[model samples]
Target: MKYLIILSLIIGLSCSERTLLEDYVFDDNDISVVKHEILSSTVNQGYTLHKLNLTSLKWFNELLTNRPIWWHHVYVSVPDNLDSTRPIFYYIDDGRNNETESPSETAKLLSEFSTKCKCITVIQRQIPNQPIIFTADPKSKLRIEDDIIASTFGLFFFNRTLFPNNTYNNVPLLFPMTKAVKRGFDETVKFLKSKNVNFTEKFVVSGASKRGWTSWLITAVDQRVIATMPIVFDLLNWQKNLHIQFKSLGGGYTYATYDYFLVGLTAKLDTKEIREILKLVDPLFYLEKYSGRKFLLFSATEDQFFLPENTKAWWQDLSIQTNNQIYIKRLANVDHYLNQQSKLQIVSDIKVFMDLMHKETSSTRTLPILKWYFENNILFGATRIKLSNLGEFDSYTVTSYSAKTKDKTKIDFRVNYLLDKSFVDSNISWIEAPLIQSKKSDLAAVNEHVYRKLRILSIFNYVGFYLDVNLKLKDSNETLSISTDLNIIPEYYPIGDCYNEECLGKLV
Candidate 1:
């Protein structure tokens, strides 16, 4: 017996030591090295603009600059295997030069993202909206400045061509460099795809002012993007409306020329034509097309031209059409340029959204149904609501009902949920218990049938309060009813009061 015990003890110690050794082993892939590489060849060495078979792109390019040009772009690389598969983001500001190297500027750029995100920084410099091939042009300059002055400014008079019209929904003061931008974006996606990098896991594209417009164009053309952060789109209109101060010469051309060029690109003969065409060019129009996509629109509350009412209109349309995936973020205290605190908040929000996105990529088939509803007025919610394995994915349905009851004058609200085009009639053992005997519950799992029926009660309060109670005397007993037909919508609410699976559920 003693010998057996001794042998067992010896074996246990040996196993423990071996386990520790394995745990301590360091793999080369474990360490992520941040790198910034400047390519030797000209950025647009062999790029071509096949899409601009239209005279419009060529004419527009000519208006900006008559000379032959070469495109410049930067590539940023970060070692894989970080806590999150975060893409090393690179921002090409409004088709401008990409010559930023200051640490403060880099930090400021990085600070725009969420601090909670596991990110390694990378910045790429690229010239915006120029043809992407190296052609034999004697007048073309090799550096960024020479290209601007000689080719764009001096040769083609792009300053005049790129100007905005200052008319509402008219040609923007800054021309849409869509063709050039599309080229860079497609190239980037192809490069990443070749490396087996999936942006669906996490990726962000954002820009301010003119770049904000550029961001909108990019999002409209590309579907692989996970999120978009467009700040102050349609700045020309906003500037004119608010009478805000403006920059004279942006990047390469005079502000006046940029404005003129924008006007010509968006010009329509009349209001009706403009409205019809704007539907295609406007960001709102494309947003409607993105059924399940996520978007964040950051606008200043005090912004003069970009009225809060206009922002609200976009939000309301998105909420009604998208089932609740679009978000509008209003920064109340600051103006167009965000303050330090607002910047931090932007970063934090982006981080949280990215984290949520990463959580979903684990399995494409099933996504945890995030419920933001009210229960007993205490306001409880859950991020992940598991449903029956069979009827998950794009097969969910939502139905809503609203009415005022007669007995005790109460408001009643209900929603019908469907799965895979059919009603989900599963068990609600845990969730039904409270609602049956009691009046409230906060359980994450419910019968597939119950979850389907309860999907349509989104009222934009953040407390996650799923129900509203009104006491009514029916016959001899008291009954409770819920309704969202309220007198006023709160100025702000968590979950954007956006219809997306965000915010609190209302019990009328």
Candidate 2:
């Protein structure tokens, strides 16, 4: 027994030492500074555009840097007659097949807009492997290769020779793409500053789909971006979205699904580890950091990659949490590739959103509020009651009633004005428990149903009164009474007491 204990201790110590060494080695090399060189310049339609290439050298674990990673950039100047003080719109282009669209295309798109702004579209092509050949057509099938895997999952598990991360194997795959984009953007900004460009301090970052996802991350990490517009990108809430996808696909598809960018390498990892990995790359986790920034999310109702419901849910939550800082627009009868009408609508929306941002007026306004309270005695000899609310509201009252007596019960929960989603353990509200019965009676036999209704009013809105009611039984087996009056009063009530006839008459 003594020998076994000693051997176990030695093995445990060795494992701990190995883990510590791995973590230390992984973070050995800090992110390297990037260098940029203007490769070429051209003049088109009264504007001068320059093509710049960026290079950065950094070591990843055991992966030796054979050559510096390269990223390409194209900067288009504002038209000579336009206002130079206008904000710059930086578009992060998705480098597909190592090709970038003509800078003139963007210039033409924004020609109709009144805002005079310079445009810089960045295309990051300097992934570790050049000319990434996908064995399967990405549109038809999911392929697990270095480029896609690295961009989607971060730099965790790829060939050491290609990525060189011998120290930190747990790194997320999306880091490489993020680092490359950030380096390219920073270098472009430096180059523009050196050229003495007279542009506004405001920077708008825009992208679609995969690039859209990157745009969110960039805005979250980089303070330079004041406004962001991401189109046809899902919330990427891994816990909810992944579970929905896995179950919807009959449990056959996972992160390995072609549509998911082949992040299936995480399948072997435990739930906690997977969450940690997602926390590193998933944009949803970082969105809360963008409190002051303007957000415009564009999604198609029938998006093939991201579900529309999930997108709306995320937008709703963001709108509530951020107090209406984010705006979402969903077009009907459109897929991932939006139609011409949807595209035009998006452009119009962008113009309006930008105009709103440029205005000096304060945009903060109270949001529509909805509160709900639920009470029931269903568990083993215990009753659980829950109260929750959404949106910006001033105050709320939860009134409970007994179905048998058809009268207001002693349970009257009230809380002062506050803006929050959770009502659990709220400092303002009070919870009242029912009196204990005699020990002679069987607790299981004393099952009763409870009904609750929540009356919520916003600080500003008066015409729209919100109310919610719920009916629940103490035991799951007990049938609810059909005669339960679940009707909720939707009349506008004043802030103070309206128990008297004169006060009640004043309520419209």
RMSD per prediction, one decimal? Answer: 22.7, 20.1
Candidate 1: minimum summed lDDT over ten consecutive residues — where? 47-56
TM-score of each: 0.44, 0.55
Local distance difference test, each candidate: 0.35, 0.45
Tens-digit per-residue lDDT, 214-278, candidate 2: 67777766667778888877656765654433333223222213423344432523345456556
For residues 147-253, what per-residue lDDT tens digits would candidate 1 score against the true structure?
33223322222233334551122222122244344444545555556556444333466666555666665555545555666664543222121111111111111
Off by over 4 Å in 2: 1-33, 56-68, 81-85, 96-130, 133-147, 150-171, 247-256, 259-270, 361-508
- lDDT for model 2, on a 0 to 1 scale? 0.45
Alpha-carbon shift of residue 277 in model 1 (angstroms): 4.9
